[model samples]
Target: MPVVWSAVGAVVFPNVGGWLGGLITVRNIKPWYESLVLPKWRPPNSAFGPVWTVLYSSMGYASYLVWRDGGGFDGPARLPLILYGTQLILNWAWTPIFFGAHNLALSLADIGLLWINVAACGYSFYHINHTAGLIMLPYLAWLTLASALNYCVYRDNSTKIKEVKKDE
Candidate 1:
């Protein structure tokens, strides 16, 4: 049925972002990331995978609810869906920028945009489906925390960041 496919698509979409992020982050966790001057507030690296898994799955399910209730993909739901897609891309970009490129400043900027996109997407989703909007709240919260973490790293490791940037 169409509903089933929509649900599947919803879940799969963010997972694609997750998968791409994993490709960049998994290898870097040991040496590169561990060496960083992370904040005291930072969660353990082990916490990230499980948290993201739940967030991505919930995001997909929320999108599915929006799609199903907003008259399907081709109907009035287009704007919110587009916003969601945009945020998803931004979400995917952050990990690579941070871990792969080791550009904390750029990563912070990227996540700032991501935060805006997520808020807009949540707002748009709220108009289409209330519960759908609610689902995005956790993601928004996480982004807030991530933005802070990124800022801290950038600030605390400015000299190192400069060296890394200069090397590139």
Candidate 2:
């Protein structure tokens, strides 16, 4: 039972990070998001729930595998796992900036960093466990698409924060 609980925690931790990010934006974001000119290829709003659900699951499982293989909190394998935590934190920051605060430019910047950290995590995980890194490839691909989407939204929507402040 204890091992099962541990596995459950491993699988849920990453999704919890994402959920926390969404919770931060739960109220203030809709109007700004609805105003954007998204690409024709963008999925319907409904698609995001399911897509993120699966993606988060994959992320959680990969994280679990890394932790299981890499040893406990203070093990020699801690380096890759530490990068994993960093990437997750960056990932968690994107939604609130993009949705809650309606800062598309900031969101773009955050996503850009998210992309880099994810790649770094992937590479580090590859050295730790090849399959664990492979599991994150889809996540990297999705973030690539999301970063492009974020950039497009920023270009089509918000003025530079500096410009807005000057006008104010």
Candidate 3:
């Protein structure tokens, strides 16, 4: 059935983003990330995986609800789905920009864009399916926290970049 595929697709898409982020993150956890000056409020590294797993799953399910209710991805139905996909791509890009490239400032900017996209997506989803819109709330909350963390990291670690450049 089309509904079934949409459901499966909703979950699969965000998980793929999560998977790509994890791959970039794993290699950088030591030396690069561990050495950074983090905020006192930062959650333990162990907390990230489980939290992200739940968030990604919920995001997928929410998207599925919108798709199923909107009568497939055509006309007005396409906008929310497009916003959803855009946010997912932004989500996937954050880890690589932060961890892989170690550009905290750029990562902060990327997260800012991601936060906007998420809010827009949530609004679009809300227009289609109220529950789907509600599902995005947690993700928006998490992004708020993440944006704060990214800002903190960028502020605290800026000197490290300067130091690296000085040595070069």
Candidate with top lDDT is 3
| Model 3 TM-score, all chains together | 0.95
TM-score of each: 0.93, 0.87, 0.95
Question: Could you give candidate 3's per-residue lDDT for residues 41-88 as a string of tens digits?
Answer: 999999898889989999999988988788758746599999998998
| lDDT (tens digit, per residue) of candidate 1 on 57-146 | 998998898888888678888999899888888898899899998888899899999999999999999999999999999999999998
Candidate 1 — worst ten consecutive residues by lDDT sum? 157-166
- All models: lDDT? 0.89, 0.77, 0.91
Off by over 4 Å in 3: none
Whose lDDT is higher: candidate 1's or candidate 2's? 1
Q: What tens-digit string does per-residue lDDT give for candidate 2 at 23-132?
A: 66556447545656777777677667667777888877777777778785677458878888888888888887778777777888888988998898888777767898
lDDT of 1 at 71: 82
Instruction: Give the C-alpha lDDT of model 3.
Output: 0.91
Order of candidates by TM-score, top first?
Answer: 3, 1, 2
